[model samples]
Target: MAIDVRIPTILRSYTGGSKAVSGTGDTLADLLTNLDGAHPGLRGRLVTPEGGLHRFVNIYVNDEDVRFLGSLEAKLNDGDTVTILPAVAGGALGFAAAHALRG
Candidate 1:
């Protein structure tokens, strides 16, 4: 199965400056493995040593957030488009917490 992956700016160096890449994998985990094989150090950036997704990173398969869909185990079919978007919070979480405390 062929999967499309989006490369965030922070990790584009591993992709030869490309913002996107494509490869084949039967599962999301396998896809990530293939990415690591191709890019060398990409897997370290995406998956933790314990094989868990990084806290600040989010992955989407066909526009569905994998966190709600079995995380790294989320299945993908041929032609699936996976997007890797890292979370960016600028006091957003703190603001929300403070607002909740005031209520």
Candidate 2:
């Protein structure tokens, strides 16, 4: 199955600055492998050493979160659009709330 992967700005370097790239696979994991073959070093940033997805990154298949869809085992179809987004840190507000609650 041919899939369209939307690359985030930070990871665009792997695709030679391309915002979107195409790959093929039956599952999300296969798609990543296909992408890595064409764009070396890209998979490492999204997947962990144990072969699971990295917590810092979020992936969605056609607007649905892959995590809720069996993660790496998520099924994909041809022409599906895969979106990769880096998790936004809560930063200051989160830190302040945690500190206040601790007190």
lDDT of each: 0.87, 0.95
Question: lDDT at 6 for candidate 2?
Answer: 98
- Misplaced by over 4 Å in model 2 are 92-103
> What is the per-residue lDDT of model 2 for residues 17-57, given as tens digits with 9 covering 90 to 100?
99999999999999999999999999999999999998779
Model 1: CA > 4 A from native: 90-103
Best by TM-score: 2
In terms of lDDT, the poorest run of 10 residues in model 1 is: 88-97
Q: For each candidate, what TM-score against the reference?
A: 0.84, 0.87
**Candidate 2, 38: how far from true, in Å?**
0.4
User: RMSD in Å for candidate 1, one decimal?
Assistant: 3.5
